[model samples]
Target: MYVAVKGGERAIENAHAWLAEERRGDRAVPELSLAQIREQMTLAVNRVMAEGSLYDPDLAALAIKQARGDLIEAIFLIRAYRTTLPRFGATAPVDTGGMACDRRISATFKDLPGGQVLGPTFDYTHRLLDFALAAEGEPPLAPAGGDGDMAPKPHVMGFLDREGLIEDAPHDDSPPPDLTREPLELPAARALRLQALTRADEGFTLGMAYSTQRGYGRNHAFVAELRIGTVPVEVEIPELGFAVEIGEVVLTECETVNQFTGSKTEPPQFTRGYGLVFGQTERKAISMALVDRALRWEELGEDDSGAPAQDAEFVLPHGDNVQATGFLEHIKLPHYVDFQAELELVRRLRAEASAAQSDTRQEAAE
Candidate 1:
């Protein structure tokens, strides 16, 4: 016998109320201010912005707080909020060549024009927990400086390009297809693929990239240059007749030089995979570059290695954690009708088998 349940709406409301109280925890502890999260949990804010495809720190912080530090949930909140906002106009492609670099390094060359700078990286840090941070006193501030003599740094790729040692990625003026607006189709363009990779789930992208490194696709790559800095954003005002600087956004960019094989028509030249992401996320940017190159095998005229990272069809759809999680978690929802049908079928099969076994046994005994 099946008894139909009711009051889903009321139950959901009560559950949400309980969840809200639980998120706050004990009333004795003071509620965390939004500014505290924005400043203290800077990396978390950056991840939310990068994944959510939004750059607002304050809003990202709020989402982080509201989501109770679940980064994917926070990203979901930020993305949902972003959909409601109206777009003004498109900004001109940011000139990363002229970025005011705070952290810049090159692995291909020992020294470069602007010189390698190691700024605020944990690469050298001992993993020991500094109990000092647990108490949290005002730490001494580092000296600030202006962008004096910040001439345009020549790209590491420029050196290879000048010598004709690398494949050329020519400038294209064709407008890219908007993935957010249109339904994702098979065999996406390079621009659309890049857009997906930029905001793709970090863990999924990282694993796929790692698979390539561990001999799946096996494109031996060197980090040509990695940079984290602020770049000016410019937007064209139709009335003004020209683009003007609107603001600046902090970004991390990675360029990887992958060894390539020459065909009869083309000479063997090093190829590049590029990644540019919001905030100072180096690992995600690097992983994104590796995956980007793997997906470009067809365009680069490389043999189809059939790696998961190399397959655009596999990589793009599973890259969004929100979509993947929703589909996976939805299994827990009410499936009474479906399960009941299966139950009946299972019971019928067992009864038929038991009757057949009894008939066989009786025949054998006789």
Candidate 2:
């Protein structure tokens, strides 16, 4: 029973004003520019874009700035703003196999086609923090690369396919279900599950993926390929009767080859788990792939170990940080009426028990 309480308009206004003041922080420090957040805090912006399901870096940076570095808050803002935009036509599926890769590597094979190109990465960096970064100074530039042939690299999984070692990827020309437009239905298709996982909270997804690695729903996975690069997006224009190249967007794609035992009607072969996300978010991409494989227990004819990662019902609903945060924070709101009702019930039960005890004592004395 929620009773409307009035007369806090002034207080509410003042509270909002105070919040704005706090968000601004001390006037002595220079205000952060959107460009700084976009360039310097690139990872943070990428996270906002990935989780918020919006591709615009500028808008993500603005949301981060407005939310005062609170990423969940930024995601909420982006999602809210996303609902207001007019619908544009959907683009063709990106050809990741033809990506102009900046970073590409394979864990399963020592040497593959399109020899490894280690772009900007933190894999070998020491954990030590550089104190010099605190001071504002221009860093030295990297040396120019030698002239080399620029061509699309072949997917590493192609090699495994030649030997019939891995299961073939299923091709579907039908349009996939849109979670943004439709409410989630249980027993979702792989495409829908992938959609939800892509926008899921990174921490939750990471933990779920880690659980699989730790023998919860163990799928012996090898990184067949992990590529980060820019891919062209094209949309078919009805008026022009042809597709035109729009722009390129950076994406990270991971394909994991997992061990699979042959089922009754199938030969033993490695299975695949795929993950693709906006921007250079390799961690999230890898996590998504692991969880993706775990959720494929039914399709792959694997035993249901009842792992949390394998349960779509359990994983999908709790994955969105925005939804989880909203439910949790709502408890901080006015629950006075509900609490009062519970209190009264408890008091009544105690009184009844006390009166019954007194009656029993009187009857015994008599």
lDDT of each: 0.88, 0.90
For model 1, residues 1-366, the per-residue Cα lDDT tens digits are: 123235766688899999899889889989988999998888889989998999999999999999989999999999889989998889999988898888888999988999887777898899999898878787878667533225678789899999999999835689988776676677888888888988899999899989999988976789999988889999998998999998999999999999988886789999889899999889889999999889889877789977888999999989988788789989999899999999999999999999999999999999
Name the weakest run of 10 consecutive residues (lDDT summed) in model 2: 1-10
The parts of candidate 1 lying over 4 Å away from their true place are 1-6, 143-151
Question: What lDDT is reached at residue 2 by model 2?
Answer: 25
lDDT at position 314, candidate 2:
97
Deviation of model 2 at 130, angstroms: 0.8
TM-score of each: 0.95, 0.95
lDDT of 2 by residue, 214-328 (tens): 9999777899899988888999999999999999898999999999988997799999999999998999999999999999999888899989999999999899999999999
Over 4 Å off, model 2: 1-7, 146-150, 360-366
The residue pairs found clashing in candidate 2 are none
User: How much is the lDDT of residue 346 in candidate 1?
Assistant: 99
- Give the local distance difference test score of model 2: 0.90
